[model samples]
Target: MGKLKGEYIILQNEQFYLKGYKDFANERLKIEDYRGNIEHIFSTIRKLQKEDYVHKTIVKCRTKSVPSFLGQGYMLEGCIPGYFLGGDAYFLCKYHDQKRFTSSMWVEEDKQLEEVWKKDGDIENKGVITPSIRKATTLDAKKLATFYASVFPIYPVPIDNPDYVKDQMEENTIFYCIETDGQIIAAASAEINMAYRNAEITDCATLSSHRKGGYMYDIIQSLENELVSKGIFCSYSIARALSFGMNAVLHKSGYSYQGRLKNNCYIYDKIEDMNVWSKDLSALSAGKSALSAGN
Candidate 1:
């Protein structure tokens, strides 16, 4: 994706991605003229569709474009408050593969899991001993892929490939893992956005045998601390909305609810909505002007 008339930036990732094609709101565009701009966007989408470059188009825009997008058969998926400095960001999607974009077992599983989390309080470690948490290295790539494949049938990236995992690690994506008996049982990562002073806490996975442990919370806290120390101001996650354990971990860890992305990703063999949660790391600042400014 490239510039379409110098007003907006189209982003397209040919590589494996869930939300691969999108249009971003740039500074040059007049927000009030979004209706006209959307026509250009639709034209671009049609051109891309004809070439078979994208199966679906996901548009992320400021609130100004919501009305125009809605008028053009796009549906609002979610909104994230303070996603762009002090403003909000909206997610909209128009699918060309509607039949393939339906829900699956993970949807119902999430609902049931959430109910259990609400009633049981924190996720228990059950009888398994707490695993040791540490940063992952390239050597852990194969194990990481295996763990991910065991949990998710479809993920954003090909986590079943060790080479891909290694590339991501080399690109500054930090992976943290919980290990026991010299084996990795759970893992997660912080996708850093240095230019925006934020990070998306994503790619969380654990082996089935390691369920119901507080390892996620521990890993999240550890990642947050690392982010804050490195001058990252915000940490956010798009968690499966139906999963009680993931949502509970974010909630208990002091993250505030933002909104929900409907049919946002293909995971666990189906399309599912994801819950948006964010934590303000700048609030923990100790008189650092840069950190304070981020708040």
Candidate 2:
């Protein structure tokens, strides 16, 4: 009924059941970082779905729980390969509102994804010269927030808040950016879940003035290097279903399309569908990045 709500979790007998929150603006319940019995989680999902009038419900669980979740009428929305300590993580979704679960843009989105994959997947295929890419610190949060504001009029999270951005930096989010003459031009972040040995390569953006220069690819590649150094083996991204540029970058980075989440979040101006892309980042035991095929 509002912008956002408090995060809640279910703990029983000193065990974790469900850990996530209700998103009021997005009209959904998000369950992530949960460890408990499947029955408890399903009960909570039912209770909350009707209580909140949520359009959709999503649960991100590990490989072992996939069959159980799917048995509860939850469908596979996507998979984060090797996300849980070398085991895979799965995103299972249930829709309270059938209309919200179906995407009108599915046909068009499929066309764009295939088009990008055919054109190129080379990291070195640059159209313009890119500036140096570097890791961002807390000092850059304000400008980074400003940069995000310029790109997205509204985002699912409080990414436009400088304080929130700073808080994320102090936490597990590592940001990367490209500066042009001391001004932040392009940026991205690696949201690390050290417990699971996974990272989410997201928050990617480039200035309108710098779009075709391969800035995004270079910036994300730099973030990947940092994530690899931190021992992350799985990396994934959820891009807008309708955004040709976003989907193209994911394809070019060697990430394979897993599935799509429908009516997932509010981005730019309204509710939008999201396409999931994932990559299993293997350790450099073979002397090359697991994602090196795209390069």
Top candidate, metric TM-score: 2
Candidate 1: which stretches are off by over 4 Å?
A: 1-39, 50-55, 97-123, 126-129, 284-295
- In order, candidate lDDTs are 0.67, 0.80
Runs in model 2 with CA error above 4 Å?
1-10, 14-16, 121-127, 283-285, 288-295
**How many clashes (backbone N, Cα, C below 3 Å) per candidate?**
2, 0
RMSD of 2: 3.5
Q: What's the alpha carbon RMSD for model 1?
A: 8.1
What C-alpha lDDT, on a 0 to 100 scale, does residue 75 get in candidate 1?
71
Candidate 2 lDDT over 1-295, as tens digits, reads 1223445665454544566777776778888767766677677667778865588888887888888988888888888777778777788988888688778888988898788788674654345667778889999989998889898887888788888889989989999999989988889999998877888888988888777677788887788877777778688999988888878888887788988888899887888988989886664423464456657
